[model samples]
Target: MNLTLKIWRQENARAKGRFETYKVENISPDCSFLEMLDILNEQLVDKLSHPVCFDNDCREGICGMCGLYINGRPHGPDDGVTTCQLHMRRFKDGDTIVIEPWRARPFPIIRDLVVDRTAFDKIIQEGGYVSVTTGGVPDGNAIPIPKKNADEAMDAAACIGCGACVAACKNASAMLFVSAKVSQLALLPQGKPEAARRVQAMVAKMDELGFGNCTNTYACEAECPKQIKRSNIARMNREFMCAKVCSEE
Candidate 1:
């Protein structure tokens, strides 16, 4: 199939960016979205032109590094899949695809389709871990955690930090992402000790990094590749309130 791509091009964080169009032909329907871009880059290189720059580490979708706003949706039209998992077959022949990087102040473009997502790393650094000494891995039955809490914790832990949640939010909020991180730990016994501190620190860092507040638009939950729930946000708000109350007391 032949396709037209209108992709954003930026030289650096401070450089002005714009959409540049290119055409690719005879792409396989089975080709992954990133593979299609690879074909386009190879063609440009043969002509002595610069290739499009995009971030991709694990093409298997586990890494969440390959993020692109395709046709105004994060990770294309697919549900519960990352850009690396998106396929060319999802588009029709001769279709024009618009691709851009995550558009948020916290995720400034480094070039073309790559943005500096270290803001996420910074938020994680703020407290997103079970720093307590839980000793070595215990026997599965030793913990005896309620199955419901364990299930919810595992679900919250599915967040891959792709910034899609931030990109999909009308306010560019990181609430969904932040909440998932908070809930994953707060529900687990290993993480319970620091739940209050972890929630406060991460939320404070999220605000300091210029991420917007959640307005309940639910776009983040809808676009999240892992289907991370907005219920995580509700849990996080409760955690935050409890922390505030405990601190005051």
Candidate 2:
């Protein structure tokens, strides 16, 4: 198929950026969005021009590195899928596809379609882990967990930190992302010991990093590639309140 692409182009973090148009032809419908971009880059290289810079790894969608705003939607117009998983078939021939990076203050632009998502790494570093030692793998039945809690924990654990939640919010809130991380640990017995401290530290770090507050718009939930529920935000709020109350005593 033939398509027109209006992609953001920036030399570096401090450089001014703009949309540069290009045309791609004869692209396979099965070609992934990143693959289409690769084709465009190759065409530019043959002309001795610089290629667009976009982050991508494990194009299989496990890694959230390929964050892009396509036609005003994070990861394009798809539901529960990342950019790398998006296909050229989603667009029609002669369609004009607008591609940009995640637009959020916390995620500073590094170059064309590339943003510094190290803010997420910093938030994770604040306390998104379980420090307790299990002392080798325990038998499945050893630490019996309620199936409900286990399922919910696994659901929350599906978050890939793609920054789509932040980009989807008018306020650029990271609540959905932060809440998923908090709930993933808070729901599990293995994470119980550090639950309070983990929630407190992570929330504090989120605020420190300039992420906005959640106002229940649910845009994050709708745009999340993993469909990470806004319920995780509710769970996080409960954890935060409880942690604060206990700490006050």
Candidate 3:
């Protein structure tokens, strides 16, 4: 198949950016979106041109490094999919694809299609941890947590932090991502001790990182590759309120 691509190009963080047109032919329908970009970069490199830069690791879709805005949607047209896992068959021949990076103040473009997502790392550093003392590996049934909460915690923990949530949001909010981090722990007994301080610290860290406020439009849920539930945000809000009340006391 043949495709016309309008991709955003930026030299560096401070450099002005614009869309450049290129044509790709002989694409395999089975190739993933990032693989397609890889092909484009190889072609440009052969011509001694600056190859497009994008972030990706563990193309299996667990790393969350492969973030891209494809045709105005994060991760293309597929539901609950990341760019690295989006198959090219989703597009037909002669399709014109517009590829860009995550557009958010917190995610500054380092070069073409690559953004600095250390803001997420900083938020995680703030308090996304279990304070329980570690010895050797404990028995599987050492502590019996209800299956329901365990599954909910695992679901929340599945978030890969790709920043699609921010890219899809009109306000560029990180609430969905932040909430997933908060809820994953708040649901576990191992997190009970730091629950209050953890929520407070993570939320404060989120605000400090220049992330936009949540407007509750649910756009984040729509774009999240992991299908992280919007209920995580609601749970986070409740945790935040409770944490604030206790912190004030």
**RMSD, each candidate, Å?**
1.1, 1.1, 1.1
- Would you estimate the TM-scores of all the predictions? 0.97, 0.97, 0.97
- lDDT of candidate 1 over 168-236, digit per residue (tens): 999999999999999999998888888898999999999999999999999999999999999999999
Better of 1 and 2 by lDDT: 1
- For candidate 3, give the lDDT of residue 225: 98
Off by over 4 Å in 3: 247-249
lDDT of each: 0.94, 0.92, 0.93
Which parts of model 2 are misplaced by more than 4 Å? Answer: none
Residue pairs that clash (backbone atoms under 3 angstroms), model 3 = none
After TM-score superposition, the amount by which residue 162's alpha carbon in candidate 1 deviates from its true location, in angstroms, is 0.6
TM-score of 3: 0.97
Model 2, 130-195: lDDT tens per residue? 886668888877888999999999999999999999999988999999999999999988888888
The lDDT leader among the candidates is: 1
Pairs of colliding residues, candidate 2: none
lDDT of 3 by residue, 87-187 (tens): 99999999999999999999999999999999999999988998667789989979899999999999999999999999999998899999999999999
| Cα error of candidate 3 at position 31, Å | 1.5
| Residue 226 lDDT (model 3) | 98
Model 1 alpha-carbon drift over 4 Å, by segment: none
